[model samples]
Target: MSPTRHGWITTPLTAGLIRGALDLERTERGLLPHRLPARARAQCADPQLHMAESQPSGVRLVFRSRATAVELDTLATKRVYVGAPPRPDGVYDLLVDGRPAGRACVTGGATLTIDMATGTVEHRPGPVATVRFTGLPAEAKDVEIWLPHNETTELVALRTDAPVEPVPDQGRTVWLHHGSSISHGSDAASPTTTWPALAASLGGVELINLGLGGSALLDPFTARALRDTPADLISVKLGINLVNTDLMRLRAFGPAVHGFLDTVREGHPGTPLLVVSPILCPIHEDTPGPSAPDLGALSAGRLRFRAAGDPAERAYGKLTLGVIREELARIVRERAAEDPHLYHLDGRDLYGEADFAELPLPDDLHPDAAAHRRIGERFAALAFAPGGPFANGSG
Candidate 1:
């Protein structure tokens, strides 16, 4: 929990607070800045690269793309490390669609801390603060989040959102989405252009994206996280991550899903929850799926392989979306008798034959920007529009 300007103790941050702070400071009135090279001073030529508040409460800067891209979502276990420190008295602003979404403040101030030798700016009296922007435009496409004070303050560690984004208003709805790398927006053009973002735009609902890149294995923590977060509409896109990770066998898969949903039900109770299985992938379609990697690609420093060994050496390794869908549908139907809101939607509904042919994924793993829009548009039409196909049945 970052400190408030008024010295109030808020557990988590509200978006409104974030906006107010950036505006108070009038940080975003100028052009974007660029980040300098590792050998040069922290300040650079590009507008986005320089530290500036896009809004009074939100700050942003173009991070040194050449250095390292910061990881956004992660479990509580890992620690974040920054190459250089931020300038003293600097404030970081978060921007949504080139506007403010949030900001971070450097505290325990110590200036003149640039490391000429290592090109790392280490500030004294650590503990930087963050404030997030709320009442955001539902149509927001991308979020421009910046860490201010690059010359003196280094963001070495971070904590996850404590309580998570809140539930929608009394009359409004919440959208909960889960998926793998595509859902996590790996190769997507920009943050706002993700399919989930597009869908949220069309649906006019709050979003909680639980899409982890290579980590969605029906883990118990993820289930608990979903179960605990508040929501009005929920959807989980399963299968691909499971297939790619090769985490469990068919025998264990069914029980794991049932248990995961059971956890979600604890908090949502009767809220609508949709389970979406994988979309079509030719590599794993007809043949037995590979739990291990194609080592030929890995040795080149390109593709990553999680599991070990070649296909011939493995005895138990196939887990298909077709298999999971059947099992998941059964679970939903079984539970629907007791919980009417339980539902299942096949992933093909988002991207089937026609759409796939029109906007094919680049690497055959994730969808492109055009596909993202298509998926989001299709999702909105099918799931959110009143009396649509996947809506609450009037019958």
Candidate 2:
């Protein structure tokens, strides 16, 4: 039962309604969403992973309520790179019974400024803000408040004119997907619109997104997390992060892929697991990277990225998208012989030259909102359509 105070009922925020997060941390402020479990987080001190896990990319509060008024309090921590353009306010998408209802944004959140060139950081404190929606229908119905995909948010409180409760499970297939920033909804309009979220909606499945911005570097802990998570379908989009971060060489990439899959198969031996190569990233397609910001664009008040590594380095075994794709395809083919449930999807097939000519990645990296929709629709048709690997009962 919800606690009532002066006609208003307060609901405790818990995992019941929160989607897309693997785990939640209770804090003095309220709850902090984490894509990785506590054990996984404790094993890695990488700042990229820390920031990515806390951003609440596909996390949302979903429930059924008859409340005419609802209010949520959040303490958000937003990022600011010294030379880049100011990011727009984070958006919260509200949906009623699977349809759009309203949208809101929290202001006055703390800011974390980074000097990318110097690797320095500064913190500016702000205050918690409230987002309220009034005039909701007084009839009990399903409601979802999707948190911002780009900002790290801490839920503080939830109050409503009528009590709210978790919506009972509807027996949807659960899809657990992991990838890089693009999959994390980097430039997607909102949480529900992220590619994985979009695909899940189109495929009629529950989503547990593990798309950790710049941290999808085949970490053992992440594989362990995937190993233990419950899911009816699984996918891992690899390559770009590994190349852009220049984290490993061609020699180590193959083994890492094998090890990651081996770990996941330990828990999900016959689960339909899809291995996706990197999408079309022209700059890093042939050239190796440790991608750097496009200072030219930055100077003109825009932010863009450019591959900074020499193309010649490929001869030395430095990884590139081209090489990664070839290797991933080979790896999948060899393993699929023994693991019939395993499958491979060329990322280029989802977004290749033809699509790039039409949609063009604005930042030379992440796709914009429109492209995300396109990819999501394509993925659903390819992966969930009849006879597809992820089709109902395929496993």
Question: What stretches of model 1 exceed 4 Å from their correct place?
Answer: 1-171, 291-317, 388-395
Candidate 2: which pairs clash? none
Give a tens-digit lDDT track for model 1, residues 250-285: 778888898988888888887788887777655544
Q: What is the C-alpha lDDT of each candidate?
A: 0.51, 0.91
For each predicted model, how many residue pairs clash, with residues at least 3 apart or on different chains?
43, 0
| Predicted candidate 2 versus true structure: per-residue lDDT over 1-395, tens digit per residue | 46666788888888897887888899988999888999999999988789889999878899999998888999999889888888888999998988888988988989999877677888898899999988899999999998998899999889999888999987778899999999999888888888888988888888888999999999999999999998889999999999889999999999999999999999999999999999899999999989988888877778899999998999999999999999999999999999999999999989999999999999899999999999999999899999888996422
Compare the candidates by lDDT and give the number of the best one. 2
Report the Cα lDDT for residue 257, model 1: 90
Which sections of candidate 2 miss by over 4 Å? 1-6, 393-395
Listed in order, each prediction's TM-score against the native is 0.57, 0.97
